[model samples]
Target chain A: MFFHKYKYGLLQTIRNKELTFWALGFTIILGTLFYAAFGNVYENDDIFEAIPVAVVENVGDDGFMQLLTELSQGEDKMLVVNKTDREKAEELLGNGDVEAIITVDESIALSINSTSDSISVSIVGSIVNEYNTKSALFEEIAKTNPEKLPQAIEAMNVNIDNVIKEHKLTDAPMNPYTDYFYNLIAMGILFGSTFGMTIAINSQGNLSAIAARKCVSPAKKSMSAIADILAAVTIVFACSVITILYVKYVLGVELGDRLGMYILTALFGSIMSVSLGYAVGSVGSIGEKAKGAILLTVTLLGGFLSGLMSHGMRQIVESKVPFINRVNPAAILTDAFFSLTVYPHYDRYIRSIIGMAVITVICTVAGIIMTRRKKYASL
Target chain B: MQAFNLAFKILKKNLGAVCMYFGIFFTMVILMTKFNPTDAFTTTKLTIAVRDLDNTTASQMLVEWIGENHDVAEADFDNEDEMLASLYYKEYDYAITIDKGFSEKLANGETDGLFTVSTSPVSYTTAFFDSQLSSFVSNVNCYVAGGFDVDEAVSKTAQSVTAAADINSLDGNEESPDAFEYYRFLGFVLVVIMISALSAVLMTMFKKEVLARTYCSTVSDTKYVMQVILACSVIALGIWLFIVAVSMVFDPQTVFSRTGVLIIINSFVYMIITVEISVVIALLVKNRSAVDMCSNVIGLGMGFLCGVFVPSFMMDESVLMVGKFLPAFWYNRALEIATSSYEQIYNAKDFATCIGVQLLFIVTLMAAILVVIRSKRQQKSL
Candidate 1:
C-alpha cells in the first residue's frame, strides 16, 4: 500500500505544472539569465591591467625615457607608454585614452584627468614619486659622498621584482562573484517548500474532497502522509540535480570538483525545504495561499540575507548578526557549497550539512506532532 | 466604469503584496544610502594584513609604511587557513608576511625574497601593493649603497617616498554622487513593483470567466478597455509620485536642483514604459505563478544586465549590447549623464536620446499588447 501510494503521489506531483515550473523551469531560466548578466564581471573589473600613460618630453631627458622604456617592455609590463607631443598627450588625456601624462622636464610631473581610473592614477603617481625621490638621493650622494656615487647608482639599478614572493594558499577559483550562482541554486531548492505545503494541504481531510474521502478509507493516514512527503522529496531532489548539472555543464560555472558532494548537499537541502513548508502548513488551518506566501517570504528573505541580491551580504549579516547565519537554511546551504569550493577541508561543509539535518528533523517532528490525532470541528 | 472599478477592486485585494514590494524598495534605498554614502572619486585604500617575522627596525618600518597607506587589519599570521578565509570573504584585501631575514637582505642590497604576500586571484590592489613595496625596497637599496646604515637607510627611503606627484581634477560639476546611485537603483525598484502590482490587477480583470461576464454587460468594448487602461495609469502614477516624494525626503538637494527635475521627468517616462510592459506580460501569462515568474526573471534580468546592480563601465561590451535593447538601460544611461562628474560634460542631446529610446520601447510594447489582445478576442469569437 505504501509503494502504491508513493507511485501515485509521484505521478500527481509530475502532473502539477505550477509546482514543476517553480522547481525546475524557473531555475533553468534564472540560471541562463545569470550567465548572461555576469559575463566577464571578474576578469574585466577586478583584475589589474597595464595603465595607459602618455609621455610629453619637455627637455628630452634620456634617463626618464630609459626608465619608461624599461617599465613598458615586458609581458607583465606596468605601463603602456605613448610618447607624444604636449598637444597630443593632452588630447589623449581628454579622450580618456590615457590615464595620466608625464612631463619629463627638470622634474617629473604628472597631469591626470579627473575621471581617470583611480588605481591606475595612483600607480602612475607612485612611479613618478619614486623616480623624483631617487633622483634627489643620487644628486645628494654625488655632492656629499662622491666616493660612494657609483655604488649608490648600482644599488638603485637592482631588480626589485624578486623582493616579494606571492603565496597562494589554495588552488580554488577565487572569483567572489560566483557566490551568486551558488545562492541561485539554493533558492531554487528552497522553492520546493511549496510542494511540501501542497502535501500537507492534500493530507488534511477538511482541505479537499479527495482528502476527506481518504480520511474515511481503511489506509493508515501516517503511511500515506509519509509516502506523499517521500514522493515530494524525490521530485525536488531530481529537479535540484538537474539544475546543478545545468549550472555546471551548460552555464560553465565553476562549482568545484566535488560534484558528488554538491548533489548530496542539494538532496539534504531539498528535504529541509520541503519539511519546513510541511511544518508551516500543518501549524494553522489558514488558506493554502497564505501558507504559500509564508513559505515564499522565508525563501526569498533567506536568500536576500544570504547574498542572493547583493554579493557580500552574507558576510555583512555574519558580522552584524551571526545567529541569523546559524539559523538561515539558505545561508547554510549556500555556505555548504561555498565551503566545498573554497576550503581545502570538509570541516565547515560538515557543519552546514549538520545544520541542514537538524532543521529537517526539527521541522519533520513538528509537522508530525501538529497533524497527529487532530479532529476537525466541522468537516 | 464597472470594469475599471473591478480592476481597482482586484488591486485592493493584492494591496498586501504591493505594500511588501514598496517596503522592500524603501529598505533597499535606505540600506544603499547608509552603506555607500560616498560615490565621489577617491584613491582606493586596500585592507591588508601583515605579519612581521623579522622584528628588525627595517621590517617594522616597512610594516608601518604599509599601514600608513592602507588599512592593516590585525590577524593571526601563524594560521594560513584563517587568513585565506579572510581573503575569500573579502574581509582583507591582501595578506603579507615579512620574511625572517627581510632587513638582513635589504642591508646587503639583496632585493629578492624579503616578504611573502597572499591575495585573491587577479586582484588589482595586490598588484598595486606589489609595485609600492618594490619601490620602497629599491629606495632603501639606493640609500644603503650611499653608505648609510640599515636603520638610516630605512628612514631616508620613507621620507623620500613621501614626495607625491600633483593630482588635479577636471570635474566641472560638484553634484552629489549619492543622488545618482539612488536614482540608478530606482530603475530596478520601479521595474519590479510596477510589473508585479500592475500585472496582478490586469490579470484579474482579464481572466476568462470575468471577461465573459463583463462582455454580457451593456458597456462598449473599446470604452471598457480605455477605462481599464486609465485605471492602470492612475495606479502607476500614484506609485511614481510616492516614490518621488520619498526621494525628496531623503535627498532634498537633488530633488530641488535642475538635474533633479530632469531625473524626475526621465523616471516618469520610464514608469509609463513599465506599465505597458506589465500589460503585455499579463496578457501573455495564464496565472499568478506565471506572473511571479515573469516578475523575477524580467526584474532581476534587467537589474543585472542594465547597470542597476553593477555599474555600466565595469560590464563587458557584449553584455551591454544586449542591455541596450532593454528600457532600463536607457533609464540608467540618462541617470548617469544627469549625475555625471565634471569631466564628462553633460549633453542634453544624450539625455534626450535616452528618454527617446524609452519612449520607443513604450510604443513597441504597446503594439505587442494590442496584438496579444486582438488574438485573444479572435479566439473568443471562435
Candidate 2:
C-alpha cells in the first residue's frame, strides 16, 4: 500500500505542470540568464588590465621616456603608452581612447576625461606622482650630497618590482559572481515546498476530496503521508540534481569538484523545503492558494536576503544581523554550496548540512503534530 | 464605463498580490541604491589586512602609511584558512605580511623579498596596492643610499611620496551620478511590476465566462476595449507617478533638474511599452500560472540581458547585440546619455534616437495586441 501511494504520488506531482515548472524549468531558465548577464564580469570588470596612456613629449626627457618604454614592453605591462603629438594626444583623451595624457615638460602633468574609470585615473595619477617624487629626491640628493649621487641613482635603479611576493590562498575559481547561480539552484529546490504543500492538502480529510476518501479507508494516515512526502523529496532532489548537472555541463559554471557532495546537500535541502511546505499547509484549513503564497513568500524573501537579486546581500545581513543567516534556509543552502566551492576544509560545509537537517527535523515534527489527530466539523 | 469599473474591481481583488510584488521590488531598489551609491571621479579605497612580523621602525611606518590610506585590519598570521576565507568573502581586498627581515633588508638597501601578500584571482585592488608599495620602498632605498640612517630615510621617503601631481579634468560640467543609477535600476522595477499587475487584471477580464457576459451586454466591442485601455492607462500612470514621486522625495535636487525630468519622461514612454506587452501576454496565456511564468521569463530575462541588473558596459558585445532588440536596452541607453560626461560626449541626436526607438516598440506591441484580440473575437464568432 505504501509503494502504491508513493507511485501515485510521483505520478500526481509529475502531472502538475506548475510544480514541475517551478522545480525543474525555472532554475534552468534563470541560470541561463545569469550566464548571459555575467559573461564578461570577471574578464572585463574584475581583472586588472593595462591602462592606456598617451604621452606628448614637449621637452626631451630621456629618463621619463625610457621609463615609459620599459613599463609598456612586458607581458604584464603597467601602461600601454601612445607616443603622439599634443594634437593627437588631446584627441585620444577626448575620444576616450586613452585614460589620460602625460605631457613631458619641466614637471609631469595629467589631463583626464571626467568619465574615465576612477581606478584607471588613480593609477595614472600615481604614476605621475611617483615620477615627480623621484625627480625631487634626485635633485635634493645631487645638491646636498654630490658624493653619493651615483650611489643614490644606482640604488633607485635596483628593480623594486618583485619586492613583494604574492601568495595564492586557494586554487578554486575565485569568481564571486558564481554565488548567483548557487542561489538560483537553492530557489528551485525551495519551490519544491509547493509539492510538500500538495502532499499535506491531500492527506487532510477536510482539505481535499481525495484525502476525505482516504481518511475513511483502512490505510494508516501516517504511513500514507510518509509515502507521499518521500515521493515529493525524491522528485525535488532529482530536479535539483538535473539542474546542478546542467549548470556544470551545459552552462559551464564552475561548481567545484565535489559533485557528489553537492547532490547530497541538495537532497537534504529538498527534504527541508518539502517539510517546510507541509508544516505551513498543516497549520489550518486555509485554502491551498493562500498556503502556496505563504510558501513562496518564505522562499523568495529568504532568497532576497541571501543575495539572490543583489550580490553581497548575504554578507550585509551577516554583518548587520547574523541570526538571520543562521535561520534562513536559503542562506544555509547557498552557504553549503559556497563553502564546498571555496574552502578546502569541510567544517563550514558540515555546519550548513546540520542546519539543513535541523530545519528538516523541526518542520517534519511540527507537521506531524499539527495533523496527528484532527476531526473535521463539517467536511 | 461599466467595463472600466469592472476591470478595476477585478484589479482590487488582486491588489494584495500586486502590492506585495511592488513592495519586494521597491525594497530591492532601495537596497540597491543604498549599497551602490555612485559618485563622479572618487578614488578607490580598498580594504586590506596586514600582519607585521618585523616589529622594526621601518615596518611600523609602512603599516601606518597603509592604514592611513586604506581600511586595514590585523590578520591572524598563524591561520591561513581564516585569511583565505576572509579574502574569498571579500572581507579583505588584499592581505599583506611583512617578512621578519623586512627592516634588516631595507637597512642594507636590499629591495628583494621584503613582504608577502595574498589575494583572490583577478583582483585589481591587489595590483594597485602593489604599485603603491613598490613606489614607497624605492623612495626609501634611494634616501638610504643618499647616506641617511633608517629613521631619516623613512621620514624623507614619506615627504617625497607626498609630492602629488597636478590632476585636471577637461569637462567642468557635473551631474548627479546617483540619479542616473537609480533610474537605470528603475527599468527592472517598471518591467516586472507593470507586467505582473497588468497581466493579473487583464487575465481576469479576458476569462471566457467574463467575455461571454460582456459580449451579450449592451456595450459594443469598441467601447469595451476603449474602457479597458483607459483602466490600464490609469493603473500604469499610477505606478509611474508613485515611483517617480518616491525618487523626488529621496533626491529632489536631481529629480527637479532638467536631465531628471527627461529621465522621468523616458520612463513614462517605457511604461506604455510594458503595458502593451502585458496585454499581449494576457491574450496569449490562458491560466494564472502561465501569466506568472510569462512575467518571470520576460521580466527577468530582459532584466538580465538588458542593462537593468548588470551594466551593459560589463556585458559581452554579443549579449548587447541581442539586447539592442529589447526595449529596456534603449531605455538604459537614453539614461546613460542623459548622464553623459566628457568621456561619452553627450549628443542630442543620440538621446532622441533612444527615445524614438522605445516609441517604436510601443507602437509595434500595440499592433500585436490588437491583432491577437481581433483573432480571439473572430474565433469566438465562428
**TM-score for candidate 2:** 0.95
Candidate 2 residues lying further than 4 Å off, grouped into runs, are: A375-378, B32-34, B37-39, B173-176, B216-221, B341-343
The best candidate in terms of DockQ: 2
Q: What is the docking quality class of candidate 1?
A: medium
Candidate 1 stretches greater than 4 Å from native: A140-146, A284-286, A375-378, B1-8, B37-39, B172-176, B206-226, B341-345
Write the residue-wise lDDT of candidate 2 on A90-160 in tens digits.
88887778988898888888877665677787777777788889988888888988899899999988988
Q: Residue A144 of candidate 2: its Cα lDDT? A: 87
Residues A1-379 of candidate 1: C-alpha lDDT, one tens digit per residue: 9999999989988899888988899888878777776757777767878889999888978887888898899888889999999999889988888988898887788887656777788888888887888888988888878899999998877778798788988899988878888998999999999888888888888887777877888999999999999999999999999999999999899889999999999999999999998998887679887898899888999999999888888887977798999899999999999999988899889999999999999999999998888676667
Every model's DockQ: 0.57, 0.63
Q: Whole-model Cα lDDT per candidate? A: 0.84, 0.84
List the lowest-lDDT window of 10 residues for candidate 2 chain B. Answer: B172-181
TM-score of each: 0.93, 0.95
* Candidate 1 residue A332 C-alpha distance from true site, Å: 1.6
